[model samples]
Target: MATPRSRGPELEHDVGRTPSLGYEPAGSYGSVRYLEHGFPNPLVRWHYHEEYELHLIVATRGKVFVGDYIGQFEPGHLVLTGPRLPHNWISTDVPEPGVALRDMVLQFGDAPLRQAAALIPELAEALPLLERARHGVEFFGLSEAARERFGRVRAAHGLQRLAEFATLLDLLVRCNDYRLLSTVQLQSFDDDAALAHISGIVDYLIEHYSESFSMAELAQRSGMTESSFSRNFRRATGNSYTDFVNHLRINKACQLLMETDRYITNVCYDVGFNNVANFNRRFLQIKGMTPKEFRRQAEARFGSAA
Candidate 1:
């Protein structure tokens, strides 16, 4: 395995043929495939699936977008995405066009998983792992043993499958080198429109965060009435339109403050907040400190390192 590097630059990958929302590949997955990869734009745009997915990104440094939280991903990073959660692993830096970014995708035969999960035993402990997978859990505890085991995931398959799966889950259930993406609402694949609509709104905010916008514009993006879009958006993301936009601005502000040497008021206007007082209040509210304090803390942590 390659030594993990620091995060840098914009992500880029091929946007290829997407998996169907209803896609469930046939096979006795429990005693089945240990590793497989053939998705055209595998690391590209967001797509949902019914089968449980265990993605082991070896060597390829990327960003795993489970829901709203986005951050650094490195080698030996294991993510178990529950059925139907829209996900995409964007390369933090562009890779060779023809030589695709490498990742081991372990897709479970949901049939066996559901069946095995129902039987009561010490295995019941694994249910918590499955339940947490609902919000797309990411492993942060990458040990040399478990890390090396993941490096083989793209090569293993058949008879030895169940045993290895148990091992993987054991590592996941026991490891502290991970953070639950968050305790988020679980809608699953049952609601497709809401899922697509929420992402559409996120894209809009990303594109126009600095510009003034209206609820009606967001509605137009989702092709729904303002009230309808607002309700669905809030329901899907656990944040209202106005509040969500504010959160995005504050998050961006926090990043700029932490990462750059920009002025406080300049950072404010840069992330969409106009009023200095409003920016200070929102930044303090979300970050538990004023902009100056936040910068001071960041400097305190990184200054000595530099």
Candidate 2:
């Protein structure tokens, strides 16, 4: 067993072919892999695999997309996504773009966990935690402790790595500061295959979220009837088309508020809202506060950090 390094990039033999949503991590060394990624890695795209992932945002503030849930993320943030849940984290420009280490990740398959749980009563208690991870979990409290465990796990090997992994899971399972992200269950392979085409449409929306596109245009592009596309899109993403677009707009609005001194109205329109009143209404619905309040709190947080 080899000790993991802080700056260890993926070796050439450590990668496998990527499927539509994401690639399978090659478990060449062990069943559990501690992988790190910089900002500009190819794995940054929206993707999924059979291996469950425990991810830590080591640096950068960004908007994370897990299923239909879009929210802000910063350093020390920890999230767990179960097998086959599509997700991506897009970094904002607060810390510049050249940071080489943005994420510390761990990927392991469920079979080994279940096998171990069958023999260990305490490990069996973690089954519920893994079940809950099907919807994705963002841990809030125990952050510092969890961060320390992540560092330890990243540097350990052999039995030590497995021990640290179990400790990390125990902390997360008992923590009260976690929230389930997606509203739906894990999608089947066929469902994911069907949604692979929809992933392209999602990519387009992410790229051109501020621009307006007609339902007919989207339907034509997806080669489905408007009604059929709407149904499938909701089934895949857990949001209506309008609500999905609004979430994207609001996420952009959050980035602008956190990073710039722009007025709330300008920020709203810059993210594609046609009216300040509607923007404010939707923003409050999604974020639980007025844009002005959000900006004030964000500024306070950053200012204190600085």
Candidate 3:
């Protein structure tokens, strides 16, 4: 994957706070808000908010960062991230004019759903799915349907919009072919400064995973002591510095293995591992399969030629 260019000037100015894009139409849609934006827009960045986001990639293919999990995404890639889980998608391939509609997003709060579930037992069925989304849930084979449902919700108002939103949730709740992207569920932090600090570090790691760096260097950069950095990092991301880096590298390796016919050894080195043996060991530990096995399985599952 090619390195993503700078995120432009808007992101540099507002990296941590959520963009106030006139969320949730008044007197109608209630808690759920529908939003769609193209690439190179100000809304695209490494940030978090107190809303569960159902995000669908309608255009472009590139790296997606959700917490410490880094992976490739193409058109139809659909994921739901729970409240306050930092995430971003950087498209590596874009035409000069850029994509007109790169993302379809539905943002909703958890409390409203929980309260509704309390009064309406049937609505409680979605609780498990919402809990799973806290770690970032990627639903497979639901992109087309999700896009249509999002449109219906977007076009409707008041009760009609709420019903359409619930319909989309119902489909997601039934999907079994899904994976939790992040290994650990991030704990909420009371300190906004600390949250922003950890989020900035995560963005740096995702963008520069191939480059070499150490916890000491990161601590120095953050102006925190080495031990303090480690503790806060673990608290915010739910992974030790080493483990988080490994997860990021392994995820990138999986993307390459599935998309390219590169040699396993080369793929290993390309994803920042130094040796084949160590790479194989770590791959097995994380993926429960060898890189060769992973490639073969991916081809078999996707019906793609090796």
Candidate 4:
């Protein structure tokens, strides 16, 4: 819970119209793949894959964006996302740059679930869980036993990995402390032309979040009129341009306020807000607390900022 250092040159968060599809090759052992990533890495981008993913946040706290849903996450945060659902987590409290272990992820294809169901008919009952995962599911307050189950899966190998995976799924399928993210099913496109324009725009905005731009400029870049660009952006992201930019700024401010020693006034300007009063208002609207209160509470929980 230490305050994250100033984001500096790092991108605050990632958002793109076309979610990048990720591929994980099956290792010599099994089809299921296990991955652990440290912060300030390249994988923390707005992307999706054909395989379903079960993700665990092992360290740090941050805001998680899955499809159109926006929320916060901390250590032990667990989420299951079905194929083609876009998701990313922006760590708000990584005290150093380089690398910090922050996530444990398991990814597998629907074929395995089908094969398991065919071998053990009763396993078919769990198929609904995969269907529900299309919208992404977040399990809150994982029981110690559940966490232990996740650890077993992470530590297992070969056939044992497969077994642990089944056990973990069974435990989660029966749990009721979870909620679905993504209010609706998002449509997918195979054509790169359809996504490239908006994706470029989103990438640019994320990289240059602290700067100001205009609709005319963005529209020109996208090869669309102002009205059409605005309409499509909202449709694709579920956020208007202003709100989308604000979301990025506020989350970046959260990291700076908690991790860095910068003054609130400086933090506000550093994150791209022109006025402290307006920054305070937007921070409260997004985080339900003023910057000072947030920093204080974070320190209390983490035993003082670094």
lDDT of 3 by residue, 66-133 (tens): 75465789999999998877677887788999887898899888999999999999999999898888
lDDT of each: 0.63, 0.74, 0.79, 0.72
Per-residue lDDT for 158 in model 1?
Answer: 63
Our model 4 lands, by Cα RMSD against the true structure, at 11.7
Two-way lDDT contest, 3 vs 4, winner = 3
Ranking by TM-score: 3, 2, 4, 1
For every model shown, the clashing-pair count is 3, 1, 0, 3
Instruction: Point out where model 3 deviates above 4 Å.
Output: 1-28, 184-284, 287-306
Query: Could you tell which candidate, 1 or 3, scores higher by lDDT?
Result: 3
Q: Model 4 over residues 201-265: C-alpha lDDT tens digits? A: 88888788888788799999889888878877776656787887787788677667645877888
Q: Could you tell me the C-alpha RMSD of candidate 2 in Å?
A: 12.6
- Give stretches of model 2 more than 4 Å off: 1-14, 17-28, 94-97, 184-306
Model 1: CA > 4 A from native = 1-43, 95-101, 109-111, 151-157, 183-306
C-alpha positional error of residue 268 in candidate 1 after TM-score superposition, expressed in Å: 17
RMSD of each: 12.6, 12.6, 11.8, 11.7
Report the backbone clash tally of model 2.
1
* Candidate 4, pairs of clashing residues: 3-258, 3-259, 4-259
Model 4 regions lying over 4 Å from their true place: 1-26, 184-306
**lDDT (tens digit, per residue) of candidate 2 on 102-181:** 88788888999899899988989889888888889998876688778878987787789888988988898788877888
